[model samples]
Target: MNDLQWYRLYSDSEPIVEKELLNKLLSNGALAKFALVRHNGEYKAMLYVNGKRINGPALPEPLTTPNGEVTHWMGNKPGVGLTTSEAEMIIQAVTDRIERAR
Candidate 1:
């Protein structure tokens, strides 16, 4: 799928950082960003957006109830986060979305 379509799919299903906070991060050009990654066969919502070897805070993971309710966990831990390619894709997708929305 294309970037926008892929973004819509992922955004709908996967857990991401809070929109407001993410927007702030992007606006500030923060090197670290937030993302959900699959690790050891389980999904991990990382605390920060990591590129290369840089590290940052850990945010709570996203959880969905059986009834489709969504909530965040209250913990932060370091883990292998998104790959460089994945981060680039996410950035491009977000940027494309913002531009299209304008």
Candidate 2:
């Protein structure tokens, strides 16, 4: 994958967020080290993992019930640029979270 090419997590049906993956990510201790920022009234997260920048919209604080769903879609596109290692880490993290959630 291109280092500058943005990519979003997806399941067999829809995007990973549609499966409430954000909740799983939020609850993961490995993800807690990132910094959350509010940009233009929206929350975004920035983390340097595996020597690459991992960034994307953040789940709203004081998460809501039934999923705490918060998706960032700009013009029908939802993703962020990441390096190969960063992308692998994200995928691994999500996979681990999914397995734990099962």
Candidate 3:
């Protein structure tokens, strides 16, 4: 089963951990305002704004990796990514989570 737990987003120098807040941000303006960070092979959030860090709220876990990140991997397949339909489903799942939180 492909199970998606939750998404923790980063925006330039902002950290958005709440699904409701993400929707609020999107509702307030365009999607360009947020810059999401990718993890493993998925999108997560981390912010860097004008050389400053903004903590929007408390998240289930720290935004930074607790034990640091790996420098090398064998199956990364740099050029490979999800198919159009796969990506669309994930986006829809994320959107559903945000809507459910509202």
Per-residue C-alpha lDDT of model 1 across residues 1-102, encoded as one tens digit per residue: 889987677665644333322311332454444454432333333445334322332334333432223233322333323333444444555455445546
> Each prediction's Cα RMSD?
14.1, 16.8, 17.4
- TM-score of each candidate structure, all chains considered together: 0.26, 0.26, 0.25
Candidate 2 global TM-score: 0.26
For model 2, where is the 10-residue window of minimal lDDT?
71-80
lDDT value, residue 23 of candidate 1: 16
RMSD of 1: 14.1
Q: Which residue pairs clash in candidate 2?
A: none
Which residue runs of candidate 1 sit more than 4 Å off their true CA positions?
Answer: 1-80
The local lDDT score (0 to 100) that residue 82 gets in candidate 2 is 34
lDDT of each: 0.40, 0.33, 0.30
Greater-TM-score candidate between 2 and 3: 2
Error of 3 at 25 (Å): 34
Residue pairs clashing in model 1 are 33-49, 47-58, 47-59
